[model samples]
Target: MRLSPGARERLTIFWMLFPTFLVIVGFYIYPTLYNLELSFTDITLLKLRKGGDWVGLANYWEFLRSSSFFDIALNTVFWLTAVSVTCRMILGLLFALLLNASFLKRMKLSTLARLILLVPWATPPVVAVIAWRWMFDPTHGAINSWLLSTGLISDPIAFVSNLSTVWPAINTIIVWNTTPLVAISLLAALQTVPQELNEAASIDGATKFQEFRFITLPYLIPTLSVLTLMSVIWTFNNFVYVWLATGAGPGTFTNVLATEVYLKAFVDLRIGYSAAIGVTMAVVMALFGALYFRLFGVGDMQEKVG
Candidate 1:
């Protein structure tokens, strides 16, 4: 049978997308499904030889019944992810604005500031954590040393170990390491803002904030929204900063869901429980993605200027 032109085009498109769909299924879907399976089983370090028996949500119940779950979940959702993401967004936008300012470009300070921003992001995460960890050490950290010199702090604070300072210390590390990327992303978005709009706003007696609010911000909202969603997902799933910085130290003082998952699997040797936690994180993220798309369409409509 002979095919029509439209049918041929559709077939070609499907052929083009076939490999990508296969890759997505292989890497993402397969592992997710396997993890879902693992979550239901009584899998463990020794059970590698023999497949573990299915327990049908017993692992999930165990986590729920545990007293530490509530605190760890709260720490994960609120302080580690939400607060850190919020700070990154605010600080990123601030830095992007500073870097993108017209006057700052003339002064050449933007170049130096941008270089400084890139340094942290370009550094390896492990190295960055190590540096930050040393800085936060109570006995011999630059932070405490400076505090002592300035008479700002009577006693040196154990930032990574102490309960009161741990979360903030983690937040500082996260924001410091992550915010540069956000700022740089926003800076790129800022570059797309039309100069004519800003000029017109200024010509109309609009203030700087007004220029940003009306002219620049509208241009950036699409990028900002996508970046915000990405930041949340990345921060939510992040394992490195927490693990290396404090090892969930000072007796689970800075424990988040990610660390809990790791501790349950590697340290405590409970693979099934770890899979349950990971599955939970995936579910929460899936819900967030759906809500995000509902509030702001999957992608913004691009307006073409005549």
Candidate 2:
């Protein structure tokens, strides 16, 4: 059957989107495929626009053989699973719940609290790193000063220089820096919850904890899942905070996959091997995404993504 004039007009509207599609295909899709192909070959920083001898899995093998590869991988996984998801979820939920409370309705007070929380978010990554690094300094830092003043410790502690404390320090900066975004998203979800449900729960003699567990928690699960996935990916790929704050110091104890890739590619000039690390990080993120989708159902996650 022949299309009507209105249908053709609608098709013309869709045709207007073709340019965006073309741009995405050319810049995003094509570059991704090129990167994948480059990962398979013995490409180097020197071979920018030329052919490289195919090396199959040699690059990956080389990466696996690196002394610090497993350490970096374990650090990445730990940060992604524990620091990123755990801290963001807990703090986001705490602030979201607090802000949604009826007693915090004074606009000036609310604004001040929100502004303070947003400081870490608004600060540039490099600047934040510098600030955090200074704070963690053993001798002259504010942290040690406060600890000494409060008698929490007898002497200054080298937060970054200590391998055991370095990851926690790095993760503290990351969690503080990124928690505002998650809090805002979760607060929006909280606001959308029906007041009637909460009121009814209260009238039925439900305690605040009970009400949250039965009413609020269920509604927040899907949003929390999406936020958790995002935090996981972002934390796994977190480089600036760890790199600048600690420089992955004490012999690279805090180096995650992203910083490892950077050190390999730029510092060591191992482009292909770094690309393999990049691919590995992507695969881990994809696995997390798959698990999230499976737990929540693909349609639900797609709805959020779309």
Candidate 3:
């Protein structure tokens, strides 16, 4: 039987997308479903060779009842909020504005300045964390040595070893690594704003702050909204810096949900419990993404990108 033109077009499109659909199902959907099934069981490393009995929701219940769960959840929320708000949004906007300024365009060193700012972002996460760990070392770290030489501190401060300092030290590294990407994205968004809008605001005798508030900021809202959500999701799920830097140690002071999941899965060998944690993380992220779409409207972002 011969198909109509529209049906034939759709058939061709489906064939084109068939490979990609198969890949997504094989890698993503299948793994997710398997993980969910595992989460409902009492599977562990020992039971991997032999199948385990399904004890429905046991892993989830145990995780929820555990004393460390609340603290880990709170730490996760704090980490996500602080990093996304300060580094990705606030400082990012400030740096983007500085780079986009007309005065900076005339400076010979502006390009060099931008490149230097991006160095941290370009560095590998593990490499960056290792370098920062050295810098924060108590005995002979560069930061301590410099501070002592400058008479800033009489003794070395244990930045990563101490409970109070560990989170802040890790956060600093994360911010430095992430800020450049945010700044670059915002800079691109800034370039899309029409020059006429700013000029009109200026001709109306508006102050620099006023011009930005009235013209530049309005244009940036959609981009900022989308970026903010992405930053939050990325920061929340980030495991490298926290794990490599401190390994969620110093008595669980810095253990976020991601690190907790890692520890449970690999260190404790409780695969089922870890899968439950993974599922929880996925659900929270999905809900947040859905709410963001509902409140801000995804079309605005698509239009801005176009």
TM-score against native, each model: 0.92, 0.90, 0.95
Give Cα distance to truth, residue 186, candidate 1, Å: 0.8
Q: On residues 1-306, what C-alpha lDDT tens digit does candidate 2 reach at each position? A: 888999999999889989999999999888878877878887777786786778988888888898887788787787534766697789988987877766777554776677787888898888877888899899889999999999999988899898777878877877788888888888888987898998999999999899899999888887888888777777777778777876666777777788888887888877877888888777878897888789888888787655
Q: Give the TM-score of candidate 3.
A: 0.95
Task: Indicate the worst ten consecutive residues by lDDT in candidate 2.
Answer: 101-110
Q: How well is each residue in 1-306 modelled by candidate 3, as lDDT tens digits?
A: 999999999999999999999999999999999999989888888889886679898888888899998889888887645554566688889999988877888876679879987999999999999999999998879999999999999989999888777878988888888888888888988998899887888888999999888888998887788788888888888899888989897778889889998998898988888999999999999998889887877786677556
Best by TM-score: 3
Cα error, residue 262 of model 3, in Å, equals: 1.1
lDDT of each: 0.89, 0.81, 0.86
Candidate 2 yields a Cα-based lDDT of 0.81
**lDDT by residue (tens digit), candidate 1, 235-259:** 9888899989889877887788899
Shift in Å, residue 220, candidate 1: 1.5
Clashing pairs in 3: none
What are the RMSDs of all candidates, in order?
A: 2.5, 2.6, 1.6
lDDT of 2 at 68: 80
